[model samples]
Target: MKPDLPTDLTWPHTSINNNAHRVGFWILAHLTHDPAYMEKVREEIDAAYLTQGPSAEPDMGLLLCDCPQLDAIWHETMWLYNTASAIRKATRACAVGGKRVSVGDQVMATFRQFHLNRELFGGDAGAFRPARFLDDKSLARRKGYAPFGGGHTYCPGRLFAQREIYLFVAETLRRFYLELVGGAEGTMMPGVDRNTPSAAAMGPERDVEVVLSVQKL
Candidate 1:
């Protein structure tokens, strides 16, 4: 199970820690499924290493992390596989559409739903494309692509989370080339099973598994 981000929680730390192996595995899976993306990342990493050397690792410094392209991949993944899909209300209130609301209102926003919104992210939004965020202004104006959240209730530990995510991904990519296993296609959808065990805030039922290979880079 992965630790999900909350509108109020700081970072996806649990999600990052508990699901690191899972996330790492899926990263490999996606790379295998799309060799092109893998090649692009490899090229960037290679170039960075050429100038700064491999010792200038992502977890070590802000060197490679300043790369926009690398950041995009992290954003896309968070969108596609947010840890939690539901947000519970603490008080009664009126909804935006003039609808009456109440305390304990269970509002759910699946990561897949928002992440794949075609209006916000164009051209096969369902498909994972890191290059989509290359245009800084456009990416900013996308409006609804909030993998973390907005406002004062915004995620507190976002900086920490981003650092961990970027570091983890950069290190994983730097160490090994990835590929999917058992000919599986990546699926970022949730499952249903109320009886399942959960270690985080996410519901007891959520299926997130992607098997992939990790070969020496």
Candidate 2:
């Protein structure tokens, strides 16, 4: 964003690339931690690529339009574990739920609070249920989910970000079979810092290690 300097993407590229890697890790971890979920993903992926051989490339259009299970898992991942924060400033003074705010006041919208709202996500809100998204298509987008910022300030790289993440899942399914590093399965979930979610990254409090084995094509 510097006008004085020549156009360079070293920083932007690094940031986006790192985020993609983190997303890949989280997806694999979730799949490993929950064998049932992993089976669901494998079934979906296998069905998706049935017409085209394992070595064949996936059709992006089919993925974007009709891949239900993949879409569910990806959306649920962001809905449940995302750590992106959106900060907004009050343009005009107003009252919110009996709380008053001034024009100059700044409001931070933390996903930790909003995404996990009991009323919005329902009773089993804490559970990782991808079916919610699959079941409710009408009212889901209007609720507490905002993995990427919405409205005018939405992430410009949203499409690219999605495609990149999809490629990670699709390519890995085609090339490698995922496995957990240690015997520790879905025994524990990491603690995350709810106060501040990093830029373009939404994940656990600590790092998770995963292993993948090459599959015969």
Residue by residue across 17-87, what tens digits does model 1's lDDT show? 54444444445455555668777776665555534544554323443455665666665565554544446
Q: Which 10-residue window of candidate 1 scores lowest in summed lDDT?
A: 198-207
Which stretches in model 2 have alpha-carbon errors above 4 Å?
A: 1-18, 50-55, 185-189, 193-197
lDDT, each prediction: 0.55, 0.71
The TM-score leader among the candidates is 2
Residue 20 in model 2: lDDT? 70
Task: Please report how far candidate 1 places residue 119 from its true position, in Å.
Answer: 3.2
Q: Which 10-residue window of candidate 2 scores lowest in summed lDDT?
A: 185-194
What TM-score quantifies how close candidate 1 is to the native fold? 0.61
Question: For model 2, how does the per-residue alpha-carbon lDDT over 70-134 read when each residue is reduced to its tens digit?
Answer: 78877777776666677788999999779898998987777657777888777878687888888
Q: lDDT of candidate 2?
A: 0.71
lDDT of 2 at 132: 85
Off by over 4 Å in 1: 1-13, 18-22, 50-66, 83-93, 102-112, 135-137, 179-217
